[model samples]
Target chain A: MLKVRVIPTLLWKNFGLVKGVGFDSWRRVGPVLPTIKVYNSREVDELILVDITASIEGHIPDHESVSDFSHECFVPLTVGGGIFNLSQITSLLRAGADKVSLNSALFENPGLVNDAAGQFGVQCVIVSIDAHRTERGSYTCFSHSGTRNTNREPLAWAKEMEDRGAGEILLTSVEHDGTMNGYDLELIERVASRVNIPVIASGGAGNYQDMIDAVTKAGAAAVAAASIFHFTEMTPLGAKDAMHEAGIPIRRRFEM
Target chain B: MKVALINYGMGNLGSVRRALEDLGANVIIAEHPLMLLDANRLVLPGVGSFGAGMERLRNGGWIEALYQQVIEHHKPILGICLGMQMLSGLSEENGLHEGLNFIPGKVLRLDKLGCSLRIPHVGWNEVNYREGMGLFNKIPQAMDFYFVHSYAVVVEDPADVSATTSYGTTVTSAISRHNIFGTQFHPEKSSKSGKQILKNFLDYTPC
Candidate 1:
């Protein structure tokens, strides 16, 4: 049976990891490698390492840095931020990244998904949509670390990404991010209901109940959070216990 | 024991190496098929389209070398994900493509299951493997492994199937034919249970 994954998102900044509020006011959390080691040992289903500034800086993911980080990371590592072409994806994979998450690059060149999935197989391409709830309550995608508005709707954009052969969708609520209030359950349900692909709900996971709500209420296949782990007393394993108790099919933890 | 991990310009070779190294196994990234001669076991780990994986393997002179190493010499080899699918008789991914034909089957798209479930069944799923088999001797029944694949091999022989997993349907998750073995899930990224699997593979001695 398919199990719900509890993924921990590591927002990468210049060198270390950071968590931002409303996609701004960044604060360094810790280094990259050690954090990955901590998560991997905790039996986290996957780790998403996004260099929040890569797209804004007009740069690609640091292959060498990712190589160093992935060596310590045993779980599936999805590296994002500033990826523009297939060559960069290839480099990230060669650096030990299991999947590459594309955002800003998709706004201009959605064909990259088709081509990347065509070559690397659909399982490797992840289209991360950062949705900022506008004043009208309609979700609009924000690109380049939520700085630029792509003017694309999350529902239609997620469907397009799925049509283009994305293996999974990482839907993040820019406003709800770092708030630890709760995942934008409605935003997640909107896209999850539209596409057949698995949707990983991100942002506003303050407690165990929040992760459970994302899966049970929002229909998210997986739940990802950063601040919940950084600020509170929540751990991935503890969240899994909560989700498992809530009747979600969670992966059985194994001993070495 | 040295294990030659075939790198035909497709697949995540680095992740596999780190995973194996964590298990205390010597892993060599084999770009050419010649490296298989020195290793005790062989690992064909890949991620890409069926046609492209075969094209790269053939162009890199891996097809003939792999055949000699696994079929002729009977070297224990394990294929992971796309590598496992390549063991099939054929694949109907984007086109009707030929595979290594090591195991009897064809790789077909999972979307044909006609279920509302997601395609490219990503994330962790349980694998129910046959007991007493060397490949899964250390793995418990219904243990979850990290899986991310759209195509699954339709095995010709039911006895060839070593493990099955539940998705929208009962799908073949692992196959074993004598000394040959393959898994649709990635063991390297599957954490503890996955590491135990790698260890079992290294110690497997098909009598």
Candidate 2:
């Protein structure tokens, strides 16, 4: 049986690791290597490395940087940011990422989602949907690092992602960005119910209990947070232990 | 050292490069013929049509050079995804395409399982090992590895199948012969299982 994942999403800038805020204003965190080393020590289930700057730069992930990151990291790594084509996707995978996350590319060329999943594998293709609350009080999907709004309902986009061959949906709440209030449980439940593939809830996580709530009450297959882990509010291990205590079946350190 | 990610102009190459470099191996995007000569190890990674990949290799002059280096020079070479498919003699993908002939077999496309199972079976798949093969090195048994492919190699000899995975039916997941080894699954992108498999291949002693 697949266990719920407690993933720590890392943002990459140039060759260094940075944290993103509302999809902009990247603050240098440290190098991705040391961050991943700590995550590995904590025995995190998996790591999500998103190149928050890729779409802006108009290039695929910096291979030289990712290549450097992979050398030090010991666990499964999922990379996103600027994955535009099958070649770029191939480059990211071959560079040592377990999966490649796509957002703006999917919205720009929906066929890319299916074509990439067809050539690679659905498991290797992660459709990352960044959503922001609309004035209409419905969640609207945003791409290009949440700058461009698709005006499509979040759940509707999620179902489309699945139908288009996305193995999993990394759903991030733009409204919840940097808040750490807890995941958008309502949004998670909405998307989780709509898509068959596992939904990794991203954004607005406050603490370990937040993870439990996201996974249990909200029915998220995985819970991803940035501020808590990025700022060291809670270590990856402590969070995992907390999740375990909360009765979420997590990947044990020994198992890793 | 320069590593060759055989560009038949299709298949996953980036993840393989990332994994190899993550393991501290110097990698090169091998396309032209001369790229294979300078590399300490050769990594032939693939993803799409078997025939197209083979044609790309042959037309690009990598097939001949790779054959000489692996078969004649006995250098360590790893074939991944469609790269693994090219190790066999032939493939049913995109009609019949001649493989590297390092291993005896024909690659066959998996029949779509009824009930929306989907062709090109994608996602985390478990490889059931028949016996201890070093391709898994330090990895534990029956772990889930990432997979994405519609065609798999049908080994002419049963002994060539190193590992198997079940979808609608049992499919060959990994195959090996002498210094030559092939994996239908993308071990580069399989996470820990993938890392362990690559480590195994990198550290594997010739039989």
Candidate 3:
């Protein structure tokens, strides 16, 4: 049986780790490398590092940092933020990133998804959707780190991304992000049920139960958290233990 | 012992190389087939479509040399992920494409198996292996390993299957027949359990 992935998503801004509530008022948590090292020790299933400033600033992701993280950590590393072109994707892969996530560039040049998937395979291309709950109660997709509204329905865009060669979808709830309340289970279920690809639910994880709810209720293949893992004293192992008790299939850390 | 990590322009070679280095094996990224001559063992690591990967092996002039090393020299070779799929006779991905044919099997899409499971079968999953398998020595049965792929090898002979994993249906995850071995999962990225498998590969004696 495939275990549910418990991922620790690290937000990168100007070469440091930061945590924000609802994608605003960012606070520096610590240096990027140290936080990664700590997670590496805990044996987190996977790690996602998103450069919050990349798309807005029109700069590429820090390949050097990705290389460093890959060298320091033995697990899979996914680098996102400001990945707009095939060359940048190529460089990141060469620099040791297992997968690259795309957002704003995906809308501007939707063909990049197909191009990257063709060049690097679909498994390596991830389309990250940041959705904000609208007044109509339907989720609207946002890009540029939740700063700009794409005005595209999250469900429709998700289906299109899959058709465009996305192997997985990283769905983030802008309304639930950094709130530490819980994931948007309804949003996750709505998106996951419609698509066959794995959906990784990100944002609003206040406790282990929230993680469980995402997988059990929303049909998420994996659950990603930033604030709960970064701001709290809980470790990935701890979260796994709780999830295991809740009957979630998860890989246990081998006793050395 | 020296191990040649084949770089055919697919998959992440960094983690695989680092894992081997951590296990104390003298690892070299063999870009050319000639570089693999001096090595005692070979690790074919890849991630991509079946057609493209085989095309690379042919274009990079690795197919002929690989056969020479594995068949004539009997040098132990372990194929990871797509590299493992390449060891089979053929693959149905992006239409039919020939494989290395070192292992008697064909690659088929997981979705076609009629299981309601997700395609690609990504994430960590348990691998059940038979006792005394060289690559699984000291590794616990049903130990979890990281896997990410849409297709899996369907071995012709059941004896060749050393390990099996289930997603929607039982799929061949690892195979070992004499000097040839292949794993559908990425042991390099599987953390501790993965490291143990790599160590076992390093300690494997090709009879």
Candidate 4:
């Protein structure tokens, strides 16, 4: 059985970990490598490191940091933020990243998705959509770390990305981000139901039940959270225990 | 033992190198075909389209060297992910392209397996092994390994398949034919189970 991935999304800014509310007002968490090492020890299914300031700063992902982090880590590592070209993707992969996530660059040049997927297999390409529900109740996609909003609808954009060779969709709710209330279940269901590829639900996970809700109700293939794992004492193992109790198929650590 | 990690300009070579080194094996990135001559074992690691991978191997003048080492010298070789797919007879990804044909099989898309499972089939899944396969020697039964691929190998000979996994259907996850071995999952990223599998490969003595 394919297990539902429980991922810890660590946001990096100026060489340290940080978390933002609604994608703004960032607060420093700690050094990047130590947090990763913590997650490494906890046996988190996967780790996603996003350089929150990379796109606004107009540079590619810091491959050196990624290389250093991945060397000490064993689980699959995915790096996103400021990946704009195929060469950048190549650099991250060479630096030990298993996959690369695209955001702003994907909107600027949607063709890059096809090109990257062509150069590297589609499995290596991931499209992240940051969405916020509008006043009219319809969701709109945002780019550039949720600073700029696009005219495209989230559902339609997700389908287009899948067709353009995105192997997976990282669907994040801008409104639900950093709030820790719960996932935007409606948003997740809307996109996951439309795309054939796997959908990773991000943002608004206050507790284990929120994670469970994302998978059971929203149809998410994976559930990711930063605040719950970073701020609270709750560990990935506890979350897995909850999911396991809830009857969601998950990979557990092998007892020696 | 010295392991030559083949680099044909794709895949996560760093992780594989680290994983092998952690198991106390001397790992070398074999950029040129001649590097394979100095190593006791060979590892073909790749991440890309089958057509391009085959073209790079051919253009880099690696096919002949690989054949000499794997087939003639009978050096144990392990193929990972795209490397595993390349071992098949042919693949339909990006058009019909020929494979290394070391193992009698063809690579087909997971969706074509006639199941409604999602494409790419990402995440960790359990692998059920056949008895007497050396790779799973100490590894637990139905252990989980990290996987991220859309295509899987369909071996012509049932005897060649060493392990199987299910998604929407039963898919061939591992194949072994004499000195040639292949795994569709990334053992380098599979944590303890993966480490054990690599250790098993390092300890394997080919007949």
Instruction: Provide per-model DockQ scores.
Output: 0.66, 0.18, 0.59, 0.55
How many pairs of residues collide in each model? 0, 23, 0, 0
Q: Write the per-residue lDDT of candidate 4 for residues A16-72, one digit (tens) a residue.
A: 999988999999999998998788778788899999999999897788889988876
Q: After superposition, how far is residue B160 of candidate 3 from its true place, in Å?
A: 1.3
Candidate 3 TM-score, C-alpha based: 0.92
Task: Kindly report which residue pairs in candidate 4 clash with one another.
Answer: none
How do the predictions measure up, each by TM-score?
0.93, 0.76, 0.92, 0.92
Residue-level lDDT tens digits of model 3 in A162-241: 99999889999998999999999999999999898889999899999999999999999999999998778887899899
Model 1 alpha-carbon miss at residue A165, Å = 3.6
Question: Scored by CA lDDT, what does every candidate get?
Answer: 0.89, 0.78, 0.90, 0.89
Better of 1 and 2 by lDDT: 1
Model 2: CA > 4 A from native? A1-4, A12-28, A36-46, A51-125, A134-137, A143-150, A164-167, A216-219, A233-256, B1-42, B64-76, B111-125, B190-193
Q: lDDT at A230 for candidate 2? A: 74
Stretches of model 3 off by over 4 angstroms after superposition: A134-138, B111-116
Name the lDDT value of residue B7 in candidate 4. 86
Docking class of 1: medium
